[model samples]
Target: MTVIHNLGFPRIGKQRELKRAVEAYWAGELPQGALLQTGKELRSRHWALQKAAGLDLIPVGDFAWYDQILEWTCLLGAVPARFEHAATADVDLDTLFRMARGRAPQGKPAAACEMTKWFDTNYHYIVPEIQPNQSFRLARTALLEQIAEAVEAGYNVKPVIPGPLTWLWLAKGEAYTQGATDAAKLDLLPALLPVYQDVLARIQALGIEWVQIDEPILAVDLPAVWRDAFKGVYSSLQQGSLKVLLATYFDGLRDNVSVLNGLPVEGVHIDAVRAPEQIAAVRAQLSAEQVLSVGIINGRNIWRTDLDKVAQLLKPLKAELGDKLWIAPSCSLLHVPVDVEGEEGLDAELFSWLSFATQKLDELQWLRALVDNKVDATVEAALEAQRKALKTRAESPRTHNPTVAEKVGKLTTLQRDRAPFSERIAAQQARLNLPAFPTTTIGSFPQTQDIRKLRRDWRSGALSDTAYEKEIRAEIERVIRFQEDIDLDVLVHGEAERNDMVEYFGELLGGFAFTQNGWVQSYGSRCVKPPIIFGDVLRVMPMTVAWSQYAQSLTTRPVKGMLTGPVTMLQWSFVRDDQSRADTCRQLALALRDEVHDLEAAGVKIIQIDEPAIREGLPLRKADWDAYLQWAVDCFRISTSNIENDTQIHTHMCYSEFNDIIEAIAAMDADVITIETSRSNMELLEAFENFHYPNDIGPGVYDIHSPNIPDQAWMVELMRKAAKRLPAERLWVNPDCGLKTRGWPETTEALKTMVAAAKELRQA
Candidate 1:
């Protein structure tokens, strides 16, 4: 009677119902009640699906309106001071939305909470802001209410919450912001545990037996004090009726395994898929009374699990622990898409090897049945099918391309070498003739609704190629006119014909497959359909040359040939598992290198190869950082170093702390690098200040993620802060990331203000 449960499920629906509902609510097209109803329906549907998959205790409290971390912020009454709310007052839906979006009913909007990548995944979470004397209370009842909803539906529910240690670990304290140590932040745990007790007490009142408290920081290289806090934190937390199953994932717990010995908890979940070698050590640490939940299935990836292999790993454990042995995905299914069943037009052979959230559940059920010696005819058939599918995937001719491999093997340091940045910047300045504090954007302009409809129509054959290109050219011309009118120094094509930055290149490149419904949430209301790199990556032809050429034709200003960098293209997609990530990344780099050659040949003066995922792809452990950074940096250099000095290779990163990785970043040798700093009020520039970074920097003057308009004075002040640290001439004005998600009105106003701010910087 081995139990099976999921740590978390995808919040966005199979067809992305949550995204539609949330976006509609944001636009005032849908009422608040309707949005809430949509959420309820999605939860009910997801719960039913989880039940159908034979989960013993379905997870609750994983669904979120914006982000799971933000939900916890509200639940713990940790809203920032700018919202002007009571510390202990229950956070309502409006206040939660305001914190996420910085929107106010009237007047100027509150500054939205800072957002950054969650662990190493592409998913973004709202960074919780904490005060020096932050006190916590159970301010919101959403978690308890969701558990009640599941119980009402006749399902045993496992309530999920971020562990107190991990929550406090992820939080950005005021003291830390002003240069206090991470160890100092752990001192707030005394005040925080009472709320954790209260929340668990409430769940116990609802008759729930166990709660999943995620403490993923256990996998990271924590300070000794932070590591020391985990035992005390869990010890205090277990003084309640509800049993705590402390979960850690994304990486292995090496020396940290010793910390789990005789822990005061009912169960401990370890990510066996990522660190299977630690299973024995971890099991040895857990007491006989403590349940051991092994995450055997892949949660972050879309590959189908091999039931035979999984059963072998779990069978020994099943005998050892009997009913106490539990199984789940290595992490939350929130990282992957919802279902693969709805995927249309994908290759049958490739489709067989694919698994999404629903399929992962099916794998979990099949594995449990096999390990428990209860495999029925249906389960047996599923196992055989999985066996054949995996075998075929290993032997498929489509998976290999000799020419691609030959090209990658013959690669040399020659391709990675570039002219010095000092020389390159001088050449670029002379070639482009740009002013001081040059104003530009991070590649894309606003992608309007009409452009989306045109793409859909064109792809569906409703619109002819001639008509499609004509419409795209019209949009590009409009973008060029707008940039010139704003007096911006550099311009982009607006990427009118592109659907996604990665997917667009994937569609053009060889050895990639796509799904009609393979959507995963990048952040709130923003979903990305990651391309599946099923084989060798090759540049079949030009990806963005024609678009860049057209935009350049429309403007005397330098129009950047925008391409998603190889490292980003690798990290952002469901890459092939058969090959090493480093090898797959190099293959991608070669492909993008060809594309860069084409862009430069097409006379594109500036080329922005966006490596935003470079930071996101960084390894969690400090010991493992060099190996990852070496390959990641090499891949980026391989893509752009082939171009001339004056081409001005530019890269953009979002929401990362680069103080540690500044040398690796500088090694990429991009002439200009832009990063998101609007949310943190340009506090990110301190890294550049500390290092005296050589290249020009574009510290974003405004947040493009929000709809709120930033005035010229505000933008000027942000630039002024940037100017105080670095040379004013080395600074560039831009907004954070792309303007694709923004509407036309705000995009225009923000760009206008950004350009004006750059001018004011010159005057100063």
Candidate 2:
């Protein structure tokens, strides 16, 4: 019989109870005991819900207050020294809050480590900083307690964890202190192993058979030495405690399959959703003692899995692994939004085609049942649901836009480029009268609570359309005056019309649907409900031209019209299954192309199309990265091409590694590219230095993630570091991303320092 297993579930509760409880606990409205109790209750409720949904192996240890990575940090006592104050048994909720929020007790400044996008998702993780010679302990036994709770509730649980390799690989630290390898400084594994051993002993004592150690980094192109390190660590831990299920997701292991098979773990999990061909190769390579967890369900997307298609994909693995086969999701449910049932306001037709965490649980249960040859009434019901859902979605009028489809097909790749960067830059500089090392923001001022309230009022129709327009325009005018006062070389509308960079565009576009309660946790208390792409995406009207034109009207300086690039919009949304991502992205490009034309016609001098999600969408394997990049670069070009050379297209990419894709970045060929580098101290500039990139560039001089204002000295040092790698004449000065999350005082001070730093460099 095929065992049904869930790799993980959404920790955000049915009604986002976890989010509320965590926030309340942080704000001191709820006691620590109440917070822990809420978490415990949520876990029990989820387990019971899965049981009711007929899941055979319900996963535990997937629930967390903030993130699973942080939980693992606690489990392994891998807390950096900054958060070590929470190590005491009597540690108050204040200590935990401080670690997560980057706040501290009175008289102590916040020692916040940098936060950035996690992989390609909007979600953020607290990056662990490890010093050389760091020691580890079993800090908190959260996992053990969770397991015990599952047992007490009469359900067996599979514990889930981010593998040590992925955890260490994701962490960041200060500059090297000695000749140690970058991986060795955080070699807390030697210390971390005993803690795992202790946790395993308890799990074994409790008779739990399986624990998933997710080593997604195995799919990456790693150095040979790390492969040996992986073997050593797994060999050391395979002491018959809890049977290890070493899982790898996001991409195929390919040549690294040997390293995966070499480990002493009991089973291996492979992602068939992304790379279906991996099954046969993995089946041929499996040893007799090992089990195979076949990842058949799509976890990262909302599309209903083609059951017959996926069932056929799993047949080879079942034939080889036999009863040892476990069917599960490709990865954690974290990437997808929470339960679809909670989306009361979602379009009914669009909702039919989608599955959230709850529905996914039901899908897995039926997949196992069908595989076991017990295909009876229950299985039939699920299959019916799946069939009906697809039928409704496919036939729905919402999915078809003949006009959009026709226009999109006619669009050529040439639409992405205005002109060659050198020519465009020269024309733009002359036309706009920009200063040397011209400074501009990445577009967006603080999304203050008052703005949020007004937006909510407008959205709910409590405020009239005229009132909303007046309020947002006034805000834009205020922003224009501020930029003019600061003598900024370029300006923006501050994006008060936008609630989110992508969501704002999504709202104006046809063939997309928004949800009232589809909030998925981005990081900490923050959440984003990505629009559902149900059909062909097309822009009915210009999304941002009105605001851009208004800001341009208020300023003599060049106002940069902003839009999320096609690749970014597609990556951030839950896209359609019938259309290839490339097709959807092209459709979006066509729509954005119209907007670019509209903006340029409205006297918008400079345009910034932000493709921050470009690098995030890169295939996890090196072999496949190029193909994805080609289409992604083409999408950006297609979107921005309607503008003239003097329009000066700029693009912003933040929280992603661009070193590997420098050529692709160059291929997009925007007049200027601003990237996030303040935290890395312009080490990212080294990518351009290595490639001798020809375009004008902006490596942000100040970190925008933190509230603490960076002074002129900090900005000056960053500029100095960047200048060493980039020519001063080729550089533009900017902040990392936007000032949306920052207060006005902090934003003003930081920009002032940034401008002063640019002035200092000019003088030198």
RMSD to true structure for each model, in Å: 1.4, 3.1
lDDT: worst 10-residue window of model 2: 173-182
- Over the stretch 476-554, how does candidate 2's per-residue lDDT look in tens digits? 9999999888878888888887888888899999978887767778776667778888888878887888888888888
The local lDDT score (0 to 100) that residue 271 gets in candidate 1 is: 93
- In candidate 2, residue 205 scores what lDDT? 78
Model 1 regions more than 4 Å off: 104-108, 177-181
Candidate 2: residue 79 Cα off by (Å): 3.9
Q: Compared with the true structure, what per-residue lDDT tens digits does model 1 show for residues 1-764?
A: 67899999999998899999988887788888999999999999999999999999899999999999999999998888888877657888878888888883433468888998998999999989987788788888887888999998899999899988788778885466522336777778888999888888888888899899999988987767777777788888774578889999998899888779777889999999889998999999998999999999999999988889889988998999998899999999999999998677887888899999999999989998899999999998999999999999999999899999899878873557877777888888899999998888887777777888999999999999999999999999998998998899999888988899999999998899999999999999999999999999988888788888888988899998898988899999999888799999999989988888888998998999999999899988889999999999988888876688888888999888888899999898888899999998888898999999998999998998877788899999988899899998888888988998888888888888788878878988
Q: Stretches of candidate 2 above 4 Å error?
A: 20-34, 81-101, 104-107, 172-192, 205-207, 312-322, 395-398, 412-418
TM-score of 2: 0.92
Q: Candidate 1 has what TM-score?
A: 0.98
**Per-model TM against the reference:** 0.98, 0.92
